[model samples]
Target chain A: MTEARDHVVPRRLIEKPAGGARLRNLGQYLFLAPALVFMLLTMVYPVLSNLRMSVYDVNVATFLSNSAPFVGLDNYVKVVSDPAFQNAFRLSVYFTIGSLVFQFTIGFALALLFNRSFPGNGLLRALMLLGWMLPTVVSASIFRWMFDGGNGIINFLFESLGLLDAPRHWLIEPNTALIGTIVANIWVGIPFNMILLLPGLQSIPDSLYEAASIDGATPWQSFRRVTLPLMRPVALSVLLLGFIYTFKVFDIVYVMTRGGPVNATTVLPIYVYQLAFNFFRFGDGAAAAVLLLLPLSIVAVGYLWLSQHEESSS
Target chain B: MNASRSNRRPGWGWTVLSTIIVIGYLFPVYWMAATSLKTNAAVYASPPQIVPWPPIFKAYVDAVINNPLALRSILNSAIVGTGTMLLTLVLASPAAYALARLNLRGATLFMLLLLITQLLPAIIIATPLFVLFSRIELVNSYPALILADTTFTLPFAVIVLRPFFLTVPTELEAAAKIDGCNQFSAFWRVILPLVQPGLITVAVFAFLMGWGEFLFAITLTTNETIQPATAALNKFIGQYGTQWNNLMALSTTVALPIIIVFASLQRYIVGGLTAGSVKQ
Candidate 1:
């Protein structure tokens, strides 16, 4: 409301010094100052430092030395050229796309199912939250066990039900491990997507559905016309949020496969960790991570845009 | 025949559909519990033990006491989680109040900036962060981790709590101001009493964000003493194979507090969660 009167971007609010309440603003800023300083120190500084690192080919072993060759465009060239880097890039795309596809499909289906009335719906909703609420590492650990070769319950069930001809190498095989991790992640992520879409469902008025019924529309047609169109914003938000969350998913892949069966599921976050911790190439790791951060930062930019739009409208 | 069957069924399709959905969600938790009980040998049994051939209490016991870090990690997680919750409210409440009630300079801009920070995935700068902490010579320190984890969580609390702060009518603050009170006095004595749900929401947001944190805890502190139970789960696997039963047992133990908090405070959470997602 005030922004229209002021007409400014990054618009400062009207600072009323004459009011008795102005003194409290001092205390408020004082309180918020530490968090602001902390963000600047830890988050802001490191981001700028990585941006600098991305432009230079600073070697790992001799990073502390001033004499380490600074080859401009070399790191980017090497990153784009190196087969391992390429493979990691390919695998990250594969993982992101595969996970997002399944996550969207299953999440939408689950949302549609749970959105309806049923016996024990409340208890079932609470139960569904279990897969989402437990820490990611725990989820990964359970998945790791389920994929175990010998006594693994997955293989036991599959073979017993004649789903597989033999005990499958669920994690050990390059073919199955990526799919397995995606499956595990799909299970974990469905609840979140459903949670978002559920409220979206609730917000859609029953009158609309009743109107569609009076028009002799089938349940499917009513849903197609009335529900899905209205749900676009929430669905869009869920999609964006899902991308942000899944793109940074490190725990499941780290724990279950550790960027393996021979680096099949080596998504960007896992690749970043491996380059730093396992390979001790901090600069290289930082560089790879910077490349990944660009897309994520774009999403953050979108979030900022939405927030501003919300403020002006509100 | 189709019309008769459909009429006779009477929403059984929806019933069966919901049952399948419920099963899909329940099966994983069941799997986790089932595996936690089975003997290592029986975990991979051919027929899969309906009940573990000989269920093990040993993993749970071992997880609680064996390396001793297990217990300490839990304590560390609790302290850090609580500390983050306190710090988030202490800092965020005032800012949220100022944004909601006090016409501070560029309150919306400040909020927009903070919201940007919340979406930032912490993984991007993990390497520099480790080195930065090392230069301060505080890499394995609790303060090192808490301060970092708070960065991840504080923006969320501030954004969620801000909307609640605004809902407190300007009239209340004005009344306090008119009654021989300074701005801070009015905020403290009168305004705060009204925003309890927002505060609870912030506290819960802070605690859970800190509780589930992993990247910085793993990267910044490699020590046994200061790490969280989150990173300790990584210790279960080594070069040879995983210690699965113990891992699940430890997970169950560590997750107890978070589950309890969610169960108790879920109502407050759902109210603010929408605002946080948009504003944050």
Candidate 2:
């Protein structure tokens, strides 16, 4: 009897003309067609072209020419072996990891602070976002001036606070240029982390905390057992997104140091920019870009997985 | 009752701490504005002037009059920003609506594609885009920057708007369909009005992306006349001797619109970020 009912339901559902259903499906696809076409032309084509151009021996002369020769794996070998690429790869790793650690820790503290109801909490949190909202160039320029060796406010403040014996060249010095850029990046990223995590903090029901309190749990215990596990998904998303964002940062380093002081701050993006634009070596630049994509793609994939899992679990 | 009272009255300490933190965070922005009004000597003083005593408007005047490119760059930024916002909305809204509402095949795949697109860094595509745009004779045009900026904003717009569309109940569209309205009109009359805030959020974000865009703006537009403010300000880095005061003036002008937008749309911006990331 159940099988017969299922058959009847199918028959009734299929009573509409197949042509009409097909036409409706086509119309639905038409809704997606414009965006898909645009992405294809702009995003997909450029990525594929980058890959193609990486294998060719293209420079200023051959870049505009149709006769650029194909050199299989040559550009990749050259970029990978170049000392500048090695230094940049090392610096990029340090910069991204350093920025992420400081940004996350400070942002988490701020998030915890702002999680509670206070008189001026809302206003303070809004003001905190100014760092994140300001244009990258503006922030970079501000930091450049603030970190200037001669007349920088930072040195002035440090001297006033008795933390320094003399003014230091933050951007021009080889040892401190990368660190200066990293400090600026950390400031820029903290608000992003806090804003994302604040919602996660809010989502935890008060009942959980109440229950914890009734059980005579300490505040630290409650945070460890209740908040940490609940906030894990949000935390993961923030870290992964932050990793990708910070890893590909160009403008901050560009404006502040220009990946300079003898390539102290030459992260991968700046490295690729210098190769492609400044030096006019399109093939090597494209090769380095592909290299840059490898690590970011891993993080991106992880983020996509975590976000999908969060959606499904919720 | 006593504990709750104490908690509620834990006032001055928290207020002072929070105020200090806020001031620390906003100090750089304050310095940017203050430095712009300082005289050259005061700006470079041994103890950097905390506030420009008897604040001067010389740098502002110099930024406006001496720097012709500053005004031109701002105009170009507006043009590019507006263009990108409009293009992104037109393309993303329909797609986002379909993905949210229609139970279509391959919807998951489309979403996955969009997610992956966000991972592709702008520099990876800069080389090829330069080649292609120059080939098509669009190297220095507004459309070139607008189109490139859309590449960054389109996925973001879709991601932000999809959740909003999901919130709009299907029953409203179904009821409209039951009446005389066709599918298009049902969407137009029933759904569009409800998602106005989402549209505005996406528009503001897209505009900001275009305005603040640096990599593509620098890569594509070699002409100062067509360059945006971000790229133009980059030129003043080592130029005009030290010119720190003038640079700060230009930076302040560039940062003003962003500050205004954030102030007015704080709610939507925060909502969009949270909804796009955490909720998803």
Candidate with top TM-score is: 2
Q: Compute DockQ for each candidate against the true complex.
A: 0.38, 0.47
List interface RMSDs for the candidates, in order.
7.4, 7.0
Candidate 1's C-alpha runs over 4 A off are A1-28, A56-71, A117-123, A302-314, B1-20, B52-55, B278-280
Clash pairs, candidate 2, are: none
Which candidate achieves the best DockQ against the true structure? Answer: 2
Candidate 2 CAPRI assessment class: acceptable
**Per-prediction CA RMSD (Å):** 5.8, 5.0
Compared with the true structure, what per-residue lDDT tens digits does model 2 show for residues B78-139? 99999999999999998999898876788888887777778887998788999999888899
Candidate 2 — which residues are off by over 4 angstroms? A1-19, A311-314, B1-12
Candidate number 2, chain A TM-score: 0.92
lDDT of 1: 0.73
Chain A TM-score per candidate? Answer: 0.85, 0.92
Task: Output the lDDT of residue B177, model 1.
Answer: 52
Question: Candidate 2 overall Cα lDDT vs. reference?
Answer: 0.87
